[model samples]
Target: MATKFKPFDVVIARYLLKPNEVFHLSKPLMYGAKINTGFGSINHDDIIGKPLRSIVFGDKDKKHKYIVTRARLPEYVINVKREAQPIYPVDASLIVQAADINVSYPTLKSVDDTEIYKEIDIFRRRGYKLAKNKRNDIKNDSSSINKKEEIIQEKLLILHGPINSYNGKTITRCSTPPLQFLECGTGHGSLTLQICKSIHASNCYFDGINDLSRGSIIHSLDRNLKHMKIGISTVSGFQKGIYLDDVEFHYEPIGPSNWVNSDIANYYRQLCDTTEFLQGCFLDMPSPEHEFTELSKYLTVDGFIIVFTPSISQIWDCYTFVKDNDLKLTLVSTFELLTGGNGGMREWDVRRVMIRNSEMVGKVVKPRIGVRIVGGGFIGIFRKIP
Candidate 1:
């Protein structure tokens, strides 16, 4: 019979030599008869002692040429610059034991591009409906959505106010300043704008990214920042914005690639950079394997990352990626809060997706729907250490 599908912690225990550190065995180590461990044992002695290179010859071809074929790459030569300290606290005796092995949040089909457009139209109509009633103080006359404060309130409604005053308080508790930070999948720039506003309030400069379109993140950022009484310096593109601060944040595009010229790439070069965060939504989806590697590069020694995704599979993938790469888990939250308003469609889209994917019952509509999602959304957070 096949081995049982063990829990993540158990599976992790087998591969890790220390907390948050995985034992990516050298060819020599893999052949050891008994893999030593604090909890249990493993045996693969048959392959021990022989240099891994000797295997290709078998019994007959001892004289075969050891040609370094380009197709068959040689084992990597990883040079350790110096002895490194433990990235995370490792108590060999303790392990991550939990009743639940994994939690999955499913992706929903309710809010595709057409649905998104429909919702946007509905949201815009709601604003006009509210403005016609002269319901609240019309603050900030910048552009079309000049009454931004009212728009913010309305947009929150669209999100069903899941991110109400209480949710904001909860998220704000752990939302500390980092040397650098990132907000990914920034759609209409709502969360990006909020984060930017908060960072500005702290007099800190952070970097964020959203895919550009005819009227997308850039448009949203432009509209929303205009509402702020403070002077918010907005720039164009990831490469240009790196100088925003010594520390910054990165939000990935819809796809991932090995080519490393993103906002996070530049931030990695800074000496003082310590903390980083990774956020995702519909606009931020990338192949899971690729995203994890992209995220790992930006992390610092004892750095932390916060990831937001709509699917439980994505969350687990992110968690495993972080763990296998020697990252730590600081906090996790499924509950997201948002006050509906204009200039934040991407934020609203995430909420909409989460509501659709999860079984959680959305709060009743308040005042009216400022931010509307056909269903709820999902989010997760993770940390990294060097």
Candidate 2:
């Protein structure tokens, strides 16, 4: 099918002359600007409105040939320049899948099986005669039907991509896309952007303010003012260029104890109480267990709680805390591994715990995939339980 490239749409251009290099650009391309490639210069306007994957020869000389395609989530994530390390696609895929971000199946099968049978039965009862040519056309359209199914699957899987930092030591924890979510310790805002995308895809609203009435809002906290500013700026850049606007950043130092009386904490409490409590809470800090008491207050019944720490000692401490507070939370899964290969290595031990809300048991969270350990860190999966 021919697809028209529209203004402001992101496009990925691959130059045939330089097979290894790829260029990402926005549409409504500047007419006069020359994109200098290894072989020759190509005008931006030459590729605009062209069907994706169509080859556009360079400057009529045809010395440098180029092909344009719609930019996918992975391409956008990889091509977007960042000061802080962004989450790699491999790790990001795992996190998104675990959260059940884009898991969906088509309804065509049900329509074909049940609806078609009902139609056939009705037609037979009515003694209706079907056109022979129409029946032949349906048979001939089987290939097109399969193609439509493929398109549906492609649309469902289009948004699968990474969220943020994966240092082998500091893994960002996640849950099934949450309507009300909290991110403690925003580092560089890589994951924040991913979360924003998730919220946006889910059609949730984020106003960057503590508005309890909003559909979805992410409250990102960081102790370091400088780092918080950087994170904010990073997300702002995304908002301006990539259009991510659902994440709110705060420079409040959140500790298990200190945040209970802070203004932000109070704001969070009001936000939670007004709109059913937080659907997910991701804790990326030195000692996440310290803040569990305060964190649990904001969590909704059957909400997800994910904690990431580099130290095994910290994991053990958090485990013990969950054990002691059996009524409030439970230990779900622990992922630990050490591996090295491909000129890279990783050593990580992380734990995932869930709130014990009693209403969540038997509810299916995404199943945990076995860790291959090609990389260093492993993620633990957990769900809130009664």
Candidate 3:
């Protein structure tokens, strides 16, 4: 909806190759602010205020022109330099959809700490769904408890609340409710970026919260610092960081059984005790079950546990581990993405294609380990077993 490209905006330039067809240029319209988009070498100065998707000539001869525009969420993920494999737009979409995510437009007036979280004799209370129309809901929200959220006992550490800093680290943040989701992997940030797009409209309406709030407060963790650094920027660089404020990237090895006892979780618990719960928990890291017992402890009664695995055995390992440990969760669904990584093309066949190795031969009865859970792997969805 923006009319012109703003400063520091990462723009996408798509050139028409033939009738009714266009393809993006290899070089992005950023960095030193100069990029040659096949038409002509574009200058940082010439693009500062240009209208998006409009024809811009590469030369004064006006021979090569491109329809320049802002990069959409999907385009940015594919084109960005990745340190690790991305979740692919296909897998990311399935994760978001299966989680039943709902977002509201963020309001400009920040939440007044006095007005929202006055009771820290206590922890933060969860927010309720008031109305879709954010423009009017915040103003007349005083008389509505009919739809108030059931305050659960699970607690979340408020990253913004007044508390002793984490080992003396600064806690410069705005007060808000406990975040809704947690992800253990921050590989290439492809899925993280996609999640940002979904929750963009409904967070950070309050003043001084995340100065760049876009309706999300995701805690994305990766043990690899290189991957974490890329994720932080890959997501922050989009749209001049329109969704940058939504995610909090942390570098931590989050998959041990003792993970709940880690310094980070302990530090959080010391500040705000057990009233915050994550609505959704995602695992894309190696051996997610190692963190399953500890992380799933923070889920609201029926919060979800979603895992993306290249091997079906991973999910099986997760399910058995949770059950064996009695982790209060139940498998809700399991799906195979036929063309999951081959872009977003979904194939539902009559005879129907199946996982790569659906069976084992000669009485060995092994699942042919590493066969993509049947040609496309699997997504395991679970719900907190109340």
Candidate 4:
């Protein structure tokens, strides 16, 4: 006999008051498995046949109720246990947008393009006529239709969490073109997951190769084995429903000076010689300044480098290093909080710098301030100049 599936057979129970405590279970609720809210125990049977969005009260406490609903990624992210501070959703959204982690839809080549010609012929056969007022209405509606089309053309896949931190922002900005990305300090792997998501969303896969040697890959290096394990677990949890196989974790510590000695470094060198170049890198160590020279060797001309530091003094050190090296300081931005509480104020200082590319003279774009203020951090962006 085949099993029959019914609506509301399985449901995710969300505490109406707490919003954080959520439980997922199948229908024909197991009698022994009951979720305990602070107020009381919620029996699985109470929710098994209830429709999604229905409110069910706790068995012991009538005052306590749970908002039955399906589990979502953002909710899961918030409720998931984390060892390190994860990047907030607002910051992640900004990072994705600023870094242009978007896929562009293909465009028709010419008026004679097959799809275009077919559409035109259909319109001609319809012989549709519009009254003067109706034509004006259609003209107004065209703008809205175009807007809808634009929205469809650009799809934003965003996951909310505290995964992307200040360092994450720098990594996202530098890792444009989704080439080779190196993260010196993995922390809790919050940023690692974000990087993996970006690489996957950008569709930066190694063509004809499934190994780490091809396409865009992230080398996450950390010294502490425990932290590395935690980071890996965190990333694995994030990748549960999503596909992000380009990220590799390493336990060895990487400094700008000795990175070449590492096995991954040799792999990257081979990749550089054959197919692609190191496009971007992020350094978040105690002394990121020391690794600049070593990073330069691996980075391609016109590549991006970003360094994160909490101290304003470190920013000065990085600025001086960029000036002395064969790189151009493009932007120096610091995130700050303007408001507090649930919906808080967040802002960042954006500094524009100029660097010569090809025969074109260097030009600095005007700096602007970010409107939202979630939290504060500092980032320095540099471009590798040949």
Put down candidate 3 lDDT per residue, 1-386, tens digits, no spaces: 66877677776655645412654533334446566654566665677678877666566687776667777777778778889888877778767777787866544434444432232211222311111122322222434422211211011122223322122223223343434577777888988977877776666463323222324467677766677667866876777667765665555543423434544343333233463346677888777777767666767778887887786667767777876788888876666666623633222111112445675322111232344322255667888866
Ranking by lDDT: 3, 2, 4, 1
Q: Which digits, one per residue and each the tens of the lDDT, describe model 1 over residues 1-386?
A: 11222111011121222323433221223333343333334333322332332222111323321211111111111111112211111110011110011212212122233432222211122221111112222233435333544554354234222221111111111122222344333332223333332233232221121011101111111122232211112211112222232222222223333312432232222212232322221123443434555655544444434444445456556555555665443333332222232211111221112267778644321222354221122344444444
Which structure is stronger by lDDT: 1 or 2?
Answer: 2
Candidate 4 shows a clash count of 12
Q: Which regions of candidate 4 are displaced past 4 Å?
A: 1-13, 17-36, 41-63, 68-78, 92-178, 202-209, 212-215, 239-243, 254-257, 272-276, 325-374
Q: After aligning candidate 1 to the native by TM-score, how far in Å is the CA of 282 from where it should be?
A: 12
Q: Quote each prediction's TM-score.
A: 0.29, 0.56, 0.68, 0.57
> Evaluated with TM-score, which candidate comes out highest?
3
Q: Which one wins by TM-score: 2 or 3? A: 3
lDDT of 4 by residue, 110-145 (tens): 222243222211110011111212212212233433
| Root-mean-square deviation of every model | 25.0, 19.3, 12.3, 18.7
Error of 1 at 112 (Å): 54
